[model samples]
Target: MVIAVPAVALFCAYATASVTRHLRVRSTGFDLGIFEQGIRGYAGWGAPTAPLKGPGVHLLGDHFHPILVLLVPFYRLFPGPSTLLIAQAALLAVSAVPVTRLAIRRFGTRGGSAIGAAYGLSWGMQRAVGFDFHEICFAVPLLAFSLECLVDRRWAAAVAWAAPLILVKEDLPATVAAVGGYLILHGRRRLGGATVCGAVAAGLLIVEVLIPAFNAAHTYGYASGSAPLSGLPQKLLTVLMVLLPTGFLAVRSPILLLALPTLGWRFWSANPSYWGTEFHYSAVLMPIVFVAMLDSPPARSRRWLPAWCLAFAALLTTMLPLHALADPGTWRPDRAATATRAALHRIPDGATVAADNRLAPQLTARCEVYLFPFYPSAALRPTWVAIPDAPSNDPRSVAAREALPSLGYRPAASGEGVLLFTRSPDR
Candidate 1:
């Protein structure tokens, strides 16, 4: 049954993308195109997405996520938008191996299998797998394995697993340090001290030096506004989302402290995107919470507790947007997707094209793709431009549609609310 978990996750994730909608590609430029474009740059192609990122945005410079460089070889081998999506599924699924072991140690085979099922079916993992591709995919497994090692008291392995976290994202060093802190509090002073020191130093260096040096913007740059934070109510609610799924069992372990930095970053973010239950930002928290639950069950009072928690978790996912996408009624085929496909077919291979956020991922493999508002497209002078007839608030599409003619583009084709524009020469 544990063997079947990854397959189910992969199928559900792949199906969600193919069926309900390409939520990953369709959203405003959150991060997939950025990663794909960055990987293309890392793989030695030009970085056209840099212009939309802002002036002088190198791949590592843009977000300080150097981990994408590791994907270069994979991209070289299999260059396409789905590469990241499939890679993300595998990464999330593989975390279950260690989680399964943790459960086995706590309870005998049958009970352990139940724990593993719960861990795999948990709302967070399901939501994350369906959430398109994200760098957090890497973080999720690493954090999950690290916590598993910590729970089993595999000190060396724990440190080793946690060490690579610095490369995942700038904010993760704080989680690493929290792991070290937990170790120290548990009486492993030597290893714990080293972990804390290294994580803090590396984190500071990345944020203050490496990131600024790479970025043309020359600052941490995430601040979307001047408001410090919305308030405690949102913070409390955000914390509730993490705890409620596991019946608050996760709080029973020291590992719960590991979530603070990530939670803090979101609740305190000036950008409202970080403040909500949506997106893959919280995927990393899922494994930590589940592993902590494995630790929560006392020998006598807890045989049934894990099962109850698992049931609740599996139940919770039904209400989540991810699993809900599997419903045929909710998924009803998308007409715009057909139109988007037709419009994308018109662009020839390897030509530069500016497309809307939704269409950008599809065109990225063959074209040097960029987001619209043409000027910011790194002066590639896109040979073609595609704009979805998006709603008023989708500024990228709306702006691209209105701006094309002024920039000397002519409407060459129209279908299912998609408008394709081309230069006079191409026409």
Candidate 2:
């Protein structure tokens, strides 16, 4: 009951925040729309092609996450972006189960519940729920359970749980390799060696062969040249932040090593986004660190740790996305959002629409949506374009808005900073 209650409470909290974000039109096309397109394809038993990425772009080429097909049946019953949002919330919330159960087995029920609540509200999971959905949601629970099995010394079950991680994302093989290393350290040499070798081979095969084969350019799309050595301080700060929730005691346990492969790639990547504490990148790391803290020598001796974690997480929540729940503005859409939604409704079903990033997810369920200013070539130009009339800092958006008239598009609907345009009759 302790485990189930906290998990259910967390689920309700996460689901409400995510669905509200979607309702307020705060979701973006780059992710929600892209994934919806791919998952919708899967729901219909077709290729996972996401036109929002670019016409006929196979999502598998962009990232190897066939595991998303698992959501198809659920999507069929309730079709929309909110489905993905709520599903992600559930996936992340349920991860607290194993973490809490393990803690209870070590600590008492009250102490276990505190630790579970802290893990549920950890900054990493909060940030992931605030952001749009990603393939990482599946990994969060898998890591939690696999690590739980590891702590219990259930070798076969741990390997079984970790094996499917590779199908979740291309980079997860590194995590799988780390799990294998942990097994070897525990003296399961033969099993651990096979796991490490298999993970390495699978990662190479997926990135070097599979992704490229499906890619339009026949090369890995995310192969940014090299890792930059700049920003060492910021990267180190991120590492420190990950440990702080656990009061830094996680460092004593070898189980903390599981987090290194994930941290390593993110810090080494040329992309700065991966280096930060923001977004879904850190969601997977929360479980690893908390579990390590459980295994740490201090966990038993220092009963105060759970209270500290709970207090810290509570303080942090006041500043995170869930904080919006306390604000009056979050409950109702403002005039701009209402008007933008009105303009979006003017777009007919099945038509191709070039929409602003913020408005794209709104129309994706009923329309073929594309990101404005980056729409396809003239012959393939979207039949409609919708953007906010309010000034944008992005130069491309500014130029695209100015060029709309000259490009033979006329305002079909306009109000409260929202504009919807369509091709002129004679054009």
Candidate 3:
């Protein structure tokens, strides 16, 4: 009851914010739309073909995540991008359960509730919820419960919980291997050895074989372009940020070693986005660090640790999206947002649309949507193009608009700064 109550409360809070963002057209197609397209395919008993990726890009080609099939049932029941948003909220909120239960065992009920609430509102979880959905949301809870099981000395359940992570994403195999390494250190040699070997093999097979097999180029798309040493300063700062909420106490526990694989890959990646304290990338690490804090067991004199962590999280929330919930203005759509939505409705159902990044999610449920300047084929150009009227400094947006006239589209609808173009029937 202690855990469930707080978890549910977080769910409602997260769901309200995420769903509100979608309603106000703040969601982007690159993620929310793309993910919805993939799930939509799954619900129809077809491959997770997200046209938003390209003409017929199998999403598995882009990333190995068969675990997404689990959402197909829920998406089928309540179809649309909001379903994914709500599901992400629930997944992230539920992760606090194992972390909270473990904390309650270590501390008393009040301390446990504080730590749980802190975990739920931690900056990592806040960034993930504020941003769009990602497969990493599933990893958050899986890592928490698996670590909790490890804390309880339930070896089989720990392995069972951690094993599915590879199916969540290729990079997660390394995390799985780290869990196995923990088992080995704890004297569960045989189980740990099997786990490490299985995780390595699965990671290699998926990254080298499965993803390449489905990828349009017949190779792993993200196999190269990383410079691990290129961003030393930013990477170090991010590590500090991850530890700050725990007042750096989590480092005392060996379980903090679990964070290595995730941090390793992100730091090694060339993308700067992975290196910073942004997006859904770090949500999985919150549980590991918080659990490690509990395992370290502060001295009785330092019983204020959990409360301090909660205070830090609460302090940071003012800079995060959750702060919007306290403001009355967030509930009302701005004039531009309302006008943009009105313009989007001008496009017909089932028509192909090359949509602006922000406009894509609004039409994803009803239209065959693609990101502007990139569609399936030149031979099958989108019948409608939707974009904001205000000048875009983006080179792609500039180039796409320049080519619109030559590609045979004319103005069909216009709102404040929103514009919709339709291709001529003769063309």
Badly placed stretches (over 4 Å) of model 2 are: 299-301, 332-336, 376-379
* Candidate 3, position 83, lDDT: 94
lDDT of 1: 0.71
State in Å the error of residue 280, model 1.
1.0
Off by over 4 Å in 3: 333-336, 375-379
Q: lDDT tens digits, residues 292-323, model 2?
A: 98874463645688889899998999989887
lDDT values of the candidates? 0.71, 0.88, 0.88
**In candidate 3, which residue pairs get closer than 3 Å at backbone N, Cα or C atoms, i.e. clash?**
389-417
- Per-residue lDDT tens digits for candidate 3, residues 318-397, read 99978879889887757767777777877888899988888889888888888886642357679999888888888977
**Model 1 clash number:** 0
Measured against the true structure, the TM-scores of the candidates, in listed sequence, are: 0.87, 0.97, 0.97
The CA-based lDDT of model 2 is what? 0.88
Ranking by lDDT: 3, 2, 1
State how far residue 332 of model 1 sits from its true place (Å).
8.3
